[model samples]
Target: MNSFEQLKEEAVRLDAADTLAPMRGEYLFPQHDGKDVLYFTGNSLGLQPKGVKQALLQECDDWARFGVEGHMLAERPWLSYHEQFAAPSARLVGALPHEVVVMNQLTVNLHLLLTTFYRPAGKRNKILFEQKPFPSDQYAFESHAQLHGLDPAEVLVELPYSEGRTYHTTEDIERAIEGMGDELALVCFGGVNYFTGQLFDMQRITAAAHAVGAYAGFDLAHAAGNALLHLHDWKVDFACWCSYKYLNSGPGGVSGIYIYEEHTRNASLPRLAGWWGHDKASRFQMKNGFVPIPTAESWQLSNAPIMSMAVHRVALDLFDRVGMAALRAKSEQLTDFLQRVLMTVRTETGWALEVLTPSDPAARGCQLSVVLPGKDRSFVKVLAEAGVVVDWREPNVIRLAPVPMYNRFMDVLELGQLLARFAE
Candidate 1:
């Protein structure tokens, strides 16, 4: 058999033996030419769970039946709706239940967490973050510095990668944090970089920041469902992630946050409060003082968006049933197979492709960011037309994520064949 045929046979064998292979049937894939497209963009937006529609319809039925009384009388009472997510979300991120809370969108939650943790005092007034984080995080950091009447240019420190490298080394990150010393008020990073798909060492980074007397946090937009996290054990001060990406909630889905339990228990900590964050027993008393709930729920500024959260609940439940350990094991193998396929394409086609994501499996997630020299949106469009779905970042990067929850080994093999056929 030819090399391509051998690869195809290998993929078929792998698929047949995969324990998680049955999960691919649970999602609704985009159709192209009367077949499921080779989808590899779960890092951007996950496939819709088949149960989402029924879940939303159930919520609608509850609303139609109960009107305002639905807050208490619905099948899943709207009054305590957000509570349902606590344990599952905590499990997803390796945090205590009290440290996790489903709340506003990703950026909004980051701002709220910053209000409590980014306290600039005396010499410690600067915020340190890795370079090229998601743009929203950069904006939040800048605005927070401005809010504190400090110049962002000085108060925000963007840690650059080591010379001639596309990603940061853990050692370099730790050295930079140490260099910042007392000037660093907070060290925040995207747990996995959105553009490069590089996973930072959250535990080591958190420890480095603490040694320098700075609070540590992360924007887990690309890392939440994509990487294995342990925020509580890592002693991470705060984190926030949107549910729409790898979590498989729909677009503009509800976001969740993790605040270390110690911070959650600090009643005197400053926050932008709302009625929903008040003590449950006395919340309806319409009291003036804000008595923050002694959990991460204290940061919430409004009631849960039940409709959006209903979708989130379904996605989180799936994670609970499958568990991160099982998902991560599959993720590592799938991503590794994708890398080998890309290597084969380069060898056969002689295409000058560079994978910008880390070669080390532990330093990255399922997403692989490839730089195809001279290829642009036109190439991406061609691939899309040919029944392969992927994400294109600006400049010349094409990001592919073979999500373990739904993607198959054959999908990776076919993608390799397509690249070899299309490359000039």
Candidate 2:
């Protein structure tokens, strides 16, 4: 068994050899008592990239120099600002550039996309989702059901976990969709379970949803920048995500959506329209006819927000530099290192905190959900006092995400020690 010191030394060696280790400096860290805080809450909100300040300053300078003409003259023109995210965000999500567009916040985009995808008429009008989806999604789905004058109870299929299982299985979701059959109009899920930190099999789930002729979409709030996605290949009908979390775009940053390129050609699909979403060529003509753009840009209701999107542009550029596959490799290694350290600490000291994230690395992302059941909830406070930043969920779960982009093997090592000491 590796002693705590041995684990620290191992971490040092591993990080020293890691090609992605230099990325830790790309993000700004908070210091507590003149020490770099052991931050593990990237799943909730990532540390800002050090380059974000420069990106924001450039936006300010461009506006100052060009005034209203900045739309055409700025470094990244304000008018086409959202377009800049298409390629990088597409790479991050494993989507086609034309299929992705950066736009409104999470729930707002969810509502907009649902309006296009969720059409409940006659017997074919039920939507399937997790029993415990994010609150916003629950409201959005329920409201979508009600909007068509359909009963939420009759039109919603709430898939529950098996009594003994920690999370939903692929078979469980497939069975639900098959059971619902033609009545299911849409199948949506949080791409990753928020509280449990479980990454769902989007490909399998989407295929299953398609088998039943139901539209497959995901609220990728937790999964977007955290997992390696292939939305286009997976045949996901639609999906949306907020960039503020693992994407490190700052709080309340701009969000993006993926609509399969095939669907973009359907000009008959109903969408809420605005001046910005109108065709760029005829848009300035202020004509009455709504000419839809042949891309995900058609779904956008407003122009991009420059300052916030400027921050996102820099962050996405980082993902482009290091690439998601390399990041996923490092994420798996870091989480494995943390889990092993926790297990070793348990073996040596008998600390019984449970790891709720799946042991199979393929089934999870960067976050590891840990629980000290029946212990004082004040454990989170103790961790915070010790400069360990983590997310606390209801009842008693500490969500620690050792993000590969900025988190080191050393961060998880320190966290393991803090957890062991906290248990004592």
Error of 1 at 319 (Å): 1.2
TM value for model 2: 0.97
lDDT of 1 at 296: 93
Q: What lDDT does candidate 1 reach at residue 258? A: 95
Q: What is the C-alpha lDDT of each candidate?
A: 0.92, 0.89
Q: On residues 1-424, what C-alpha lDDT tens digit does candidate 1 reach at each position? A: 2377778888999899899888888889999999999999898889899899999999999999999999999999999999999999999999999999998999999999888888998889999888788889999999988999988988988888888999999999999999989988999999999999999999999999999999999999899888999999999999999999999999999999999999999999999999989999999999799999999998988988999999998888888878889999999988988888888888888898899999999999999999988788899889999999988898999999999999999999999999988986
C-alpha RMSD (angstroms) for model 2: 1.3
Residue 135, candidate 1: alpha-carbon lDDT: 87
